[model samples]
Target: MKYYSTNAKAPLATLHEAVVKGLASDSGLYMPEYLYKLSADFFDSIQNLPFNEIAKIVATAFFGEDVEQKALDEIVDDTLQFDCPVVEVSDNIYSLELFHGPTLAFKDVGGRFMARLLQYFIRKEGKEEVNVLVATSGDTGSAVANGFLGVDGIHVYVLYPKGKVSKIQESQFTTLGKNITAIEVNGVFDDCQALVKKAFMDEELNRHMKLTSANSINVARFLPQSFYYFNAYARMKAAGKADNLVVCVPSGNFGNITAGLFGREMGLPIKRFIAANNANDVFFKYLQTGKYTPMASIQTIANAMDVGNPSNFARVYDMFDGDLQKIRSVVSGATYSDEQIRETMKSCFDSNGYILDPHGACGYRALEEGLTDGETGVFLETAHPAKFKETVESAIGAEVEIPERLAAFMRGEKKSVEMSADFDSFKNFLMTR
Candidate 1:
């Protein structure tokens, strides 16, 4: 149950240290020392259990050594109140609808799970305060903000790129006035992420406040994402289509897909995976060439996948011992342009009466092109279509009715401080205010 830094420079840490610290002192992501594979009987009975029931077993397998059975049960129950159902989108391709939670995105599982787990740690240790810093290109801000809202002894600061996120995405976090503060960063997501990483490493900031990240870089945040993949497999199994199963995830910070890979390693019976990318295709290019080179990100309709230098890539590299052929055997890549995303969204709507948000469109298109015969592909519909109302409407030539939750959020008054993406400015703001 011990976690080690992917960089292999920091001391080995307990699950508590890894979750609370968020990032290593050496600026590396923390990963579990060893992954525990599930038993065959577990998978045999998984298809018959409820979503939360399946989650409890899987969560226990990963976190049981670190957390007590009763406490872990409560955490899994609190986190998985919502369901993720796999809906057939094409003949052999399905879309795992992961947007049924409060924030209507896949990250809700991680955000809520992390919030509960962190609060458990806080209450047990009598910590005065813990501040969560999260960077988002889109859905993560809302998911984290809503997840941590009003939690005792915790404050959340959501840093999102100005004008890059959808209005609904921005509103969901910025309007939450208590315990959650949204900062409109005058730069891209990479800048916001850099600021968080720097703040975690800065001695002055650490002295002033307990700093941890809710970004995928945090094991507490991303490891719970494995719950989503397991739930998807369970659902597929119930439908009697578990054989030759392939999961496709829309990759941004690479947390979602990496969690899926973890599930595969844990004997999830998944045949392979597809990391669908938008215009910011650094990971895709790396999968193609076996050389990872980070660059500045470009804006795309699938804004959530717009990360240039994914922090979780380090964990992915470490998980497979930096073996390219090993990664390629179970995982593949596909990149799409904004035009292609629009086209796929339109086509899905026209052909099947199914609406896809831009991010899911990339996943759907990738699965459509990549799935071979006798394989059933399940692409993650990571967010609700209504989240990107305007863009989706334009693409499908039909109106997207805003969900009640999103509509309420949009009506709330915005209340975030505008700040430059500079580390000094961010640090000073935190120290001064």
Candidate 2:
């Protein structure tokens, strides 16, 4: 399938090109030219299908024509070796636990899928050493780093804001010595993201080193995230709780929610979406006043949702055909303060005995406030609570035993290049190295 840029200036690109090029030449995010809707029969059988089986069906819609079914299925299977089960937290709200992966974050699915798909294209095209430039608030760095770790022909550079990421989150990327390099930027998440974008658009740097983004601006990373939404719907369908189902996503750069919106376009039977926000509430403010405004990000316990100027807002705008009213009708917005997130996290633990990472707390709270009677809600518990060890422990006043996976990460010494957020410093670092 062909893809078009949200900016509407770049020529349409094939799926492979969109995956490799990441951001369009016009500095716009790439979107599919057409959304392939699933058949009624597929939804009818969705309840019985395994996670990878259902993932293959959905992945085929965007990638089947471009990739052979066998190869595509293998990619889907490899990407989804872990489970994403929906657990009932209450009578009306269910938590789609997505942290059962190597990185203990929901971005693992997208990161792994993108890694395999990009590697396939690299081998097919006989390209040499494509450097992946990714900026993470918290989880994206670890997810992308671990997903692409030791994969041939691709080197990943994870740029994250210094001191903003959790200790385990930073360790997951920084500890891996080969093929993954972590750059600690002395700024916020947006600054790190800006450095990635500037490097992509830099003519001199592009000539010296082949660069692409693993951020959600890349079609490969964001589109594969739609898998969880389908899986969530299928599970809900099986339980006969699909009626008036609302899916709540913790929003940051808006990539995750944008992918869910794609699932809705493909007839996923979702009633609506709730874009949950932390301190960086640009989208929430937009939903309130119907005006788009961006500012600096504020630090919150839910660090992953701290994007002031989300890169993928353009994609969501394009997805609904630039119709604000149409967008508002299908999706709702809610914001939570650090205090509210803490309260929700503590309350859920006290009530349901379920631990929530700060990001998941925002999602769960949004559903609690927004969902009406008879409307069952599924909030995405985006990561394992132990990933945010200190914050979660402080909120709940309980010691969380570190899992073996996280303990392994914590044991390694940190190794990261420190840099200012300036593009010149970033560009010079890339050009020199």
Among the numbered candidates, top lDDT falls to 2
RMSD score of candidate 1 (Å) = 0.8
Worst 10 residues of 1 by lDDT: 53-62
Give the Cα error of residue 107 in candidate 2, in Å: 0.5
Deviating ranges (above 4 Å) for candidate 1 = none
Judged by whole-model lDDT over C-alpha atoms, candidate 2 comes out at 0.92
- Model 2 lDDT per residue over 23-88, tens place: 999999998889899999999889999999999999999899899888899999999999999999
Q: Return the TM-score for each candidate structure.
A: 0.99, 0.99
Question: Please, what are the lDDT tens digits per residue for candidate 1 over residues 1-433?
Answer: 8988988899999988998899999999998888888899999889888989888888887899988899999999998888898899889989999999999999999999999999999998898799999999999999998989989999999999999998999999999999999999999999999999999999988999998999999888998899888888888898999999988889999998888888888988999999999988888898889999999999988888889999888988988899999888878999999999999999999999999999999999998899898999999999999999989999999999888988999999999999998899999999985
Report the C-alpha displacement of residue 48, candidate 2, in angstroms: 0.5
Error of 2 at 302 (Å): 0.3
Query: How far is 222's C-alpha from truth in model 1 (Å)?
Result: 0.7
- Residue pairs in candidate 1 whose N, alpha carbon or C atoms collide under 3 angstroms: none
